[model samples]
Target chain A: MAALSPGNQGVRLAVRYLVLILIALIFIFPLLFMLMNSLKPTEQLLADTSSLRAFLPVGDLSLDNYVDAFKRAPVGTFVFNSVLVTGVTVIASLFICSLAAFSFVFLDWVGRGILLSIILATLIIPFETIAIPLLLIVSKLPWFGLNGLEIGWLNTYRVQIIPWIADGLTIFLFVQYFKDLPSELVEAARVEGASWWQVYRRVIMPLSGPVLATGAILKFLVMYNQYLWPLIVVQEESYRPVMVGLGYFFQLNVAWGEVMAYLSLITLPVLAFYLALQRAFIASIASTGVKG
Target chain B: MARVSLKGVRKSFGTADVIKGVDIEIEDGEFVVFVGPSGCGKSTLLRMIAGLEDITDGTLEIGGRVVNDVAPKDRGIAMVFQTYAIFPHMTVRENVAFGLTIKGVPKAEKAEKVAAAARILQMEHLLDRRPSQLSGGQRQRVAIGRAIVRDPAVFLFDEPLSNLDAALRMDMRLEIGKLHQQLGATMIYVTHDQVEAMTLADKIVVLKDGKVMQAGSPMDLYHHPANLFVAGFLGAPSMNFISVDTRSVDNGLAMVANAALDPIEVATTGRDIRTGSRAILGVRPQYLVPSATPAEGMLHGKVTLTERLGAETVVEVGLNDGSRVIAAFGEDRILAPGTEIGLAFDPRQAHLFAEGDRP
Candidate 1:
């Protein structure tokens, strides 16, 4: 093949960057519109929705909507609840699911293959099909918390966190990633007198940074954006997460600016979590292609 | 160092037998090599000895203790894998110190042992570097270093030098030999390379189809292979096999004749040989020489191809009976294709095996 001329190379590079920039703008336009209009009055926000001005801060702006979004509902409590649930669930799910995946990939026992298949089969079943039964089960589950023995798990953080700790998607992600690792590493560790737990903690987990980041980011998105399960289970305002708390802005008046402010605020945690792990997440995707 | 022994050790995964009843005795501080073709249960037998694979039947004794059910770590063995199996996440020092850390050894003792292993491998300067930063030979050294710190009685090597380049394989092969001498430990090495088995092993075990063909000192197996498989598997160009008919059996020698040659007396140790029975005559390529004149007990053939290596020339000859044989000459010979040649070998150097004597 002949080498490209210097002029052609420059033109090719420019066209590539132009296409990338257009794709970037297509994704960024919605977030820009939300942030720009969050500062505008509700009347101006609604009026500019049809034009590009909605994506720019061209109208009268103030911090009143931010204050009003916080005032109309307990946005602080809701954000705290979502972060707590998402954070705890992400950490616990990574631990439990990775352990389960380690067993599935490395150990040999009867019924393992069938059990894994059954867990993976749940992926095809949407949450709505099991949501009612799950709600009933958690409502009657026993818990001994700071308030002593409780027969029901409703209106508490445990109800949201425990059920999401061991899901098929997270375990499947870990199983596929663990399968790609060198089996010789595991055998070498075993021959060196390492217990199974020590092998998982030291040898396996140290090399699992990419998969851990990938699993954390995925579980964070799923838990943070949860609406129905928590909505049907918890009826208390104090235990309301961000997605359920978004209902407070949809009153009879329906303040669009305040609604945008609430959305923009809630989106921060998700963005921060993704940005912190984007390097490893991108690496995982590049290597494994998002098995989930 | 400790002696290792396998007494009727058999391994079967479900109904398929991988190592079918293998028995071997490895003396203390001896270097024994398990050599065979791929899928011949050489690696499977090594893994069974290492406790990485469970033994389905029979007993394995290490230092006079039956350890059939013992764990790998408790069996007092360390292994260097073909892939090196060095932890990519850890530095050289950390990798060597892993076993010591698992044992909860004192910090000072661990550091001193790591330094000693590093110095032995001449990798003290690379102790802080990760495995990714090192060359293939260096990573293999780190793996050996990790095994060295464990101070086990027996060391297992599963085709460790197969991953190296030709020149590097030779260099590492010498290093492993020197390491065996320095440590004076019982080392059971597995490889399919006959050169490695010949040069490095104090004792060689040849296997085929999950059964041991023969096991003995290298020269013993070379000079007197128990079966045709050992004869063919041990040599470089491999022994040339020609079908022959036995005319008479007297004492321990048999009178054999073929269509390409006159009757020749070849030594046989088989008790089942009978007159008017078929057999195979085996001769090494190095022993066959071109004769100046056609004579009795000489094979008549036409030269088909010649490989002129610098020191020696190898000629492939087609026998008159429509069979092919190779001959390696010490001095280069200018024999072109389609040239008639007469090949002769000493009777004592030829081996005779009864037909259907596989093991």
Candidate 2:
């Protein structure tokens, strides 16, 4: 801090450091306020709501906000619902996308050019265009899907997962990932007399973990953040995921403070999942090397 | 281990025909090299025989049975690709065992076969390494080991050494020649390098534009090339072709005049030639000599460029009529640029092609 005139320079340096500290505090202050308020008694929280002067409400830094959050909006059930639905969908998307990618990249199936074109065409078709019809179809009975046979999507897990599977984004990710894989590897497997499944299972799958994890993580984030679709069909509060239930929870309880607690709860898992999957994504992109 | 035959086989990618009616008969345990310039369908023909490509027409037989519709795995053939198509994900051991494993061979036999093939290819120390971890030569060795473990009736190699450095290429070339002899398996090797074709093959199948130009012993093709393409394709610093009028010499030998020289008597018993017919005289650089005395085979030309290959020097000479010719010399021989080199040819080794065709 010492420079020119020691006293004045020290004062100037302190001011510069204070400005940087103030900027940092401005960003972190709101989160600190929320966390502290979440711990405060309602009476004190409302009295000085703008300040961050409160300590833990209970002697042992009370977990009352968490307990209240679970009771008020079915947090446990909502989280479980999210993990199950999104987890299964991620797994299924990875499987289906990997299979499609395997087929597109390696096998000499006829009309692959046309098939690839159709799949690529899906990429530009936004999910919003299909959302209403998809929800309507999911709300109703299914029919003539294959060989004129009837299928149903009414209030079923299919209502969420099927539409998500048909999402072009996932397939595009897989196809792009698979397209760069070495064709020589597949040719080698073929020369070794491996059936297509063996090639996909033994070679492609083991090698595709990074992209698969990335694709799965992406799907999980989308399905986790999803509110509109779940809001329309998931009438059962227990069946509702955290995002949709967060909306309904606000309308019913009006617990702004507790919802912040809920927001914190919902937000951390998504961040953790993203962090976990990001490593895989980075690894996948690295190993794929350069793509033509 | 067995004979292979490709009869009237044709392949067309859409309307553009790549292989136009090729027929090649490979005898039991013979190493046949397919040599051609790029886009000449040599690799495509090898792929056809390997069952990697559809025949489109006619039949491919391996071990004496048609394999037109047979699966590549079931075709009694194994192929080593130019890229050394070893599975990057698998260790050398696994790559070698993959064929046996796919055939549902017992784990014990798979291990035994893989080990034996590894030993044969001298890749036992690298059994645990993936293809990416190995050098280009090692990867190619593993690829050949993979083929060997199959104990296939025929082995197909598609430019397997094109990726290696020159030193490694020479090493692998000798290794492959030894492999052919040791395995006693019918091998159809495709390479654009005629030296590989000459050194490794019992019979060399020269191809061009999807058709077989000629198939014969390398020496036979060298001494008596069937056509211009065969003569041009068979050698490095390739054979030189100088056009000349053919005339019957005294002792019933057809002598081709070197314009500058008196005459070169070519040894051929044929009397079917019509007089005054034009022919292209073909002679290799190694056979051309810088004559000591002015006489019979002396063809004078000025040296244009000289390339020394340690043991030998190759001199490209421009003739008086502006046509160029090449002469190969031992290191002791010296020629400077613009110096007139009195070149002579061995008449016995001299060849004549009628107009566009070599007889």
Candidate 3:
């Protein structure tokens, strides 16, 4: 190493940079180890756990674990169920939240303050605090138009979509966002002879690019990796999200090699999504802090 | 262009009254100014007319149509705010054409309107740049261009020049005057500067505590002020008031005097003026002149303070009984502090305020 200067300022700067790199490496080592573990053979894993030599096969390698992972579980069926429920919930939640938020903000309804207070009050409550009462409500779906249209949420796909909107956190996020938004922009649009729907579609929605990106990514992650609610509601093998299926996989087949490959497979989509949405994630957190 | 009127308009925030029953009638194509001190409810009244704030009481009529419940866009008025509220994300051309583009105007016609507005404001060179990239004066020009593109019947400016520097403010003032001369749009401007009101307005409205003190032309206000507040507020260095009583001179002629002056002629004959009324004489600083000795309409005093402001001297002359008045002088003034001096007044220019009457 080069000799540090006598003054402590240069030494401090060098030490801080080195510490940051070390912390980053420590945080990232688990993913690297997991990747290496997924590539090793059974014999080599039994031989050594901490050596680089054990990561590759001795003579020839095969994609046997991936094939076995697909055989032991209906991976395609799980992915379809996950994507379908998550897709509907994301679109529905965004539309409902933005509409309600715009109404509470711009329109001078009589009970606007009370409505906002009730929405804000839900933020202090956690979803787990109301899970039992929520499950009771979802088990008996409201009769809107037709008879025998009940959505018995235990072991059903409808269970996932209802809880997504019923969770007050999403509405709270939208309301807080709409409250701080500049009303001058909305007024200008109204002055230009635009209807309320036109204003929301042309002006409010276009201006909410960053918030929507962030909300979509956050909601997708929350619903994609859901386990507790899905476990309580879904009992059938074909109706669960991919995360619940992975947990069921470990219980039925105790083969650690196949399990490791399956878990790694399940993590790829979320990891890719994280990489794609890092910018939106940072903007949402930083800007929402300024909204208040 | 449209004329605007406010009949018995009032606004209150909870228990506090801000605008209390203000009525003003502005003529068509006439430029009027609302001038007052801060916290005088001037800006709030402008917002009520724009329909940005709800009218708590009374009616607001624009071009003879009641618009108290109508939305801001349908009010046929465009406004420029004090903070230069141009959209920071749009180009200068986009900002100018935003109102028409929202109205679904054709692209070719939108371009023509934007081009015409930019041409009038002389801002054609900076159309492609964003507001963040333009200078303060350039941004203000772009703001005025935005108002012009909409072709509003009544243009509302809420202290638009306050954000600019002094030199740019003067330049933009000249441009606005020329624009008014060309367009002849009905405009209502609000400012605390009396100079701006004097220089730009076809009529000036003086507001005090949410009430209109007086409304007239600049020269009418300067020459014939309805009360003491208007007389004191309109001029630089303010008008000076000396409490004097009416008395009989050697002949049957009635003259006015206080303590340090010879009697001055009084031709005022009204029931308000009598022998025992507590009346004060008002005179501007420039009207008082230094006299070599005591002459008709002359007063004697000792110089207390001398303020030389490059062009003229403002001398505070103290009377023998310890009251002082300011006198503006030319470059040749030689009065010094602690020196005796005499001054004369023109009786025709003096204003009288009775004790119990409004100024």
Candidate 4:
């Protein structure tokens, strides 16, 4: 094969960047429209929906919608609830799921293969099929909290956080990552007098940064975007999450400007979580490709 | 240092038997090597001794105590793996001190031991670097340092140098030899490389198909291989096997003859051999010397190929009976293809195996 000339290389490079820029614009257009129209009045917001001006912020704008968005509903409590549940679930899932994965990959026990197969088989079953039964189970479960021995777990942070702690996807991610690690490290650790717990905490977890970041990002998205489960379980205003709280903007006469403001507000936590873990997530993807 | 013994040790995974019943005795302060081809249960036997694999039958003793059910840590053995198995997240100092840390040793004592091991391996300057920051040879040294810090009763090595390049493998082999001398610990090393086994071990155990073929000093096994398998497995350019028929068995020697040569007396230990039974004669390539004339040589053949390797020349000769034999010469010889050549060897340096005798 012949090498490309300098002029041809320049043309190819420019074309590549042009294609990438077009893709970038396609993804960013919706976010641009949301941010721009959030600053306009409801009349201008609805009128400009069919034109490019809706994404340009050229119409009359003010801080009225932002102020009204907070006053109309308990937006602060909703964002807080979502962040709290998502953060706790992400942390606990990384711990419990990684432990389960560790047991599956390293330790030998009876029925291990069958049990792993059963757990992975859960991935094919959509949550919609089991949501009703899951809601019934969590509603009657007892909790020992500040008001010791609570009879039911409805309208509580634990209700959202505990059930999502050990799921099939997170555990599967950890198992695949753990399987790629060299088994010799575990044997060497054992021969060096390390207990099983020490191997998990010191040796395995330290090497699991990329997988942890990946699992955290995935679980955060799933839990923060939760709507159906929280809608059925938590009817109290104080326990409502961001997705269910979006319903408040859809009353008899919807406020388009205030709705955009609520969406823009709720999208902040997910964006921040992803940006913080972007490097590790990319590293995990690149390494997985290389290993495969 | 401690003595290690295996009494009828065997291993099975499901219905397939990996390691058949075998026995071996290793003395204190001795460097023993288990050398064999792939899938010969060498690594499995080493793991069984380290308590990494469970024994299916029989007993294993370390320091005069049966430790079949003991955990790897409690058995007082440290193993160096083929992959080095150094923790990529930890520095060399931390890796070396891991065992001591698990034991809850005092900080000063742990530091002292780590320093001593680093000094022994000559890696004190690399103590602060992670495994990813070091080369393959350096990572292997860190692994050895980790083992040294434990100061265990025995050291186990599972093909530790197989992952290194040729030059690095030579350098590490010498370093391991020096370490064994410096520490004077009982060690069991496993490798398929016979050069390593011949050079580094005080005793060499050869295995084939999960059974012990022979176990003795390196020179003893080389000179007196019990069967045809050991004869071919031990030497490079291996021993040349030629089929022959025994004419008569007198005293301790057998007179053998083949179509390519006259009757020659070869040494054997079998006492139940018949007078006219088939046998094999084993002779090393180095023992075959060139003769001036075919009439005066014990064997006569035509040179088929020659490999001139600077200091020595190896020649492959085809016998009249449609068989081939290799001969290595000390000095370079100009024996081209299709050249007629004659070779001779001493009877004492040759081995004879009867049709079905075990040694």
In terms of DockQ, the best-performing candidate is: 4
lDDT of 2 by residue, A112-133 (tens): 8798789888888876787788
Candidate 4: pairs in clash: none
Candidate 2's displacement at residue B110, Å, is 1.7
lDDT of 3 by residue, A1-292 (tens): 7766678777898899999999997886666655555555556555556575444434334567667879988877787888888878888888888788878778878998897789788878887888888788877765343556555557777788766853456666676776666765665556545678877886778667667777777788888888888877788988988888887556753665566677677777778777887887787788866642
Interface RMSD of each: 0.5, 1.3, 2.8, 0.5
Tell me the TM-score of each prediction against the true structure.
Answer: 0.98, 0.88, 0.85, 0.98
lDDT (tens digit, per residue) of candidate 1 on A131-198: 99998899899998788999989999999999999999999999999999999999999999999999
Question: lDDT at B309 for candidate 4?
Answer: 96
Give the per-residue lDDT digits (tens) of candidate 3, residues B9-53: 999998888898989999999999998888788888998998888
Q: Is candidate 1 or candidate 3 better by DockQ?
A: 1
Worst 10 residues of 2 chain A by lDDT: A52-61
State the lDDT of candidate 2 residue by residue for B83-124, as single tens digits: 887777788888888888888999988888888888888888
Q: Please provide, for model 1 over B1-359, each residue's C-alpha lDDT reduced to its tens digit, 9 standing for 90 to 100.
A: 99999999999998998888888999999999999999999998988888889999999999999999999989999999999998999999999999999989999999999999999899999999999899999999999999999999999999999998999999999999999999999999999999999999999999999998999999999999898899999987999998988999998889888888778888787646778999899999999988988655798889999999978999999999999999999987799899999998898899888777766
lDDT of 4 at A33: 89
Model 3 chain A worst lDDT window (10 residues) = A52-61
Model 2 TM-score on a 0 to 1 scale:
0.88
lDDT of 3 at B229: 81
Location of the lowest summed lDDT over 10 successive residues in candidate 1 chain A:
A283-292
